[model samples]
Structure formats: structure tokens, C-alpha cells
Target: MNELKDKVALITGGTKGIGLGIAQALLSQGIHVAITSRSAKAAEETAKQLNSSATKARAIGVKADVRDFESQQNAVRLVLSEFKQLDFVIANAGLGHFASIEELTLEQWQDTIDTNLTGAFYTIKASVEALKKSKGYYISISSLAGANFFAKGAAYNASKFGLTGFTQAVMLDLRQHGVKVSTIMPGSVSTHFNGNEPDSSDDWKIQIEDIGELVVDLLKMNPRALPSKVEVRPTMPPSK
Candidate 1:
């Protein structure tokens, strides 16, 4: 925690869900954070909520659309201007568009691929230089669908699969620069993903804070080691 104090982290799609969870955890560790959302209102409101609970670190909000390369670039610039350094980049902005090939529309497919795959590329491209300078970490929130495909998940699966592979290749490319990169593939996380509301029924699913803790653990690991890729799921989900 002491080692992480005063460091800066940027989380995309951070108004809620896994990104917001990670932001909270980082701030609790005395790491300042900037959270981005497509809605300026959401970003600022979430940042205020984070600041209220912050102990030793501060929180700021930026409006950015990860699907746009220029938007991502501007976001990184804003963070750099405010924090003076970027120590961590969490590319957590992603969306799912699930449907069978026969039912999926071209718009749905494009949105999924653009937001989940190309968005991650834009995020890393925009922040890689800053990360290289700081020897920072880059983490992406992927999904188990990346590794295992299923019916009605064509668009979602393709996007996540691309994200997983992209993050791994990025890991190989950035390690020599001392910038760590990894992807977290989670299964059935209790978030408002795909319009499912979370409730007590979600108790058996992986929680956002759990992912946050995993990220913190990764950050605390010795520089000699890297987890590179992590696949996390509920230990005891109801039998299929």
C-alpha cells in the first residue's frame, strides 16, 4: 500500500461495475484515480462518490468514448495534466451484444467489436507511452466467453476473444519496456452487464470487488513475476 501511495490510475467505463470497483480499491490503497464514462454527468457524479469515501487519494472524472481513438487520446492527456503521471491504466470499457448469427444485426456486431476490441486497442495505444514512462501496469476486463463460445453469444464472444488475445500480445510487447499488461477473464460477474439487474440472486456469482482485489494483488506482486492472464469464476455456482 505504501508503495502504491500517490500513484495515479485511470479506469475507463468506470461509472460502475468492475471499473468502479477497481477505482475504489485503488483509492483505498492511497492511489489517485481518474474514471471515464461516455456521459459527463455520470463520470462526475461517480467521481464525487469516490471522493467522499477516499482516504488518502483523490478521484476525478473524464468524459471519454473508448471507441474513438481521438477521445481516448484526449482522456489520457487530461489525466496527465491533472496527475502529472500515469501509473496504471485499466481498459474496462466494454459492452456485450448477444445474439445468434441468424438474429444478430450488423449494428449489434459492429458495436460489440468496436467497443470491446477496438476500444481496448485505442486505450492501450493512447496510454502506452505514458505507461512506458512510468513502468506502469495495464489491465483489461475480458470475459470467459473469450475462451469458450456458446449459442447466442457470437458478437460478445468474438469481441472478448479478440480482447484476450490482444492483451496477451500487448503483454509480450510491453514487458521489455517495463510496462506490465494482463487481461482478466471473468465468468458471470454480478454487474448490470447486458441489462441484467443485480440482486441477492447474484450471491453465487463473482463480485466486482473480488476482481478489484485480484487487480490489487497483481499490482503488489514482485516485478520478477507477472500473472499475464487470469481466468476467474465462481467457486460454487449452481449446478448447470
Candidate 2:
């Protein structure tokens, strides 16, 4: 715990699942966190739930769609206005569409790529100036699909693969400017991703909190050391 007290963090898609988990983790560490989602109502509700009378005020939630550059830019502006300085950003807004290449519609492919890959680009691009000013950190939430393709996952696999490459390149580009970049690739997290209810059957999946804890760990690492990339998976899964 490198004492994240007073540090400001901006998380996209922070209203639920992995993003929410990460926001909660940062809040527990006394970090001033601001989260964004497409829905204004959801964001406000999540912020209320995460807020505390102690620990540097809870979190601020804003409405921003990752697929839109203007929306992401507005999110950055909101973070800067609320926190005065931005220390870290997590681009966690994404969607998965699973379909074989032959079965995938052109719209489906574009939607997945736009939301998962280009969305991250919008998020990071909008926040770069603030990050540079604070020598901050950028963490992209990737997935195992980024490297290991699965059946009927053409769209998802392509997006994650592109994201992984993009994250690495950004890491190299930002390091010299004092901004650290890293990607967290998690395997089968038990989240309500793709609009499914999270259930006990998903126990074999990595818990959302597991990813949150990893993010906390990354933030606490010494500035001189950058992990660059992390790949996480459950030690054991249910027998198929």
C-alpha cells in the first residue's frame, strides 16, 4: 500500500463489474476517484454507493461513452475540474461480441472494434495531457483473448489483439514523458460483461475484485519500476 491518499484516478465503465471493483479498491485506499459510464443515472448511483464520510470523499461519477471522442474528452475535463490533477486512468469500457467470422455481421465487427479498441484510444488520448502533467499512469483492461483466440470470437479476439498491441506501443511512447502505461490481461473474470447476470456458476472465473486488487498493486509499485504488462488467470477452474 504505497498510500494512494489524495491521488486522483479516473476509471471508464466504472459503474459496474471490473471498473466498479477497481473504483471501490481505490476508494478504500483513500484515493480521490472519478468514474465514467454511458448512463448518467448509473454513474450517480454507483458514486453514492462507493462514497464514504471518511477517506478523502468517495468518488465522482460522470456520463461518457467511450465510443465517442467528444464524450471521453468531456470526461477528462470533468476529472480535471473535480480533482484539480489526474494521477491515473483505467480504460475499462468494453464490450464483447462472439461470432465466427462467417457468421459475424459487418456491424457487429465494427461495434466490437469501436467499443473495445478504439474506445480505449479515445480515453487515453483525451487524458494524455493531464497524465503528462502529473507523470501519471495509464492502464488498459485487456483480456486473454488478446493473445489466445477462441472459437466464434473473431470480433472479440481482433479487438483485444489490437488493444494489446496498442497498449504496448503507448507504453513505449509515454515512458519518456514520465507517464507510465501498462495493460492488465485477465482470463474469464466473473463479471456481468456482455449483459449477462453474474452467478455462482461463475465461481471458477476470476473474481472482479481480483482484477481490482491487481490494479491497486500496480499503482503501489515504485515509480522506477514498471511492470509494463500483466497476465492473470484463475489457478483452477471447474472441470469441463
Model 1 over residues 27-132: C-alpha lDDT tens digits? 9989999999999999999999999989899999999999999999999999999999999999999998777899999999999999999999999999999999
Clashing pairs in 1: none
Top TM-score hit: 1
Alpha-carbon TM-score of each model against the true structure? 0.98, 0.96
lDDT against the true structure, each candidate: 0.94, 0.91
Q: Mind giving the per-residue lDDT tens digits that candidate 2 earns over 125-209?
A: 9999999999999999999999998899999999999999999999999999999999999998898887778888888888888
Candidate 2 C-alpha error for residue 142, in Å: 0.3
The reply for model 2, stretches above 4 Å from the true place, is 52-56
For lDDT, the strongest prediction is: 1
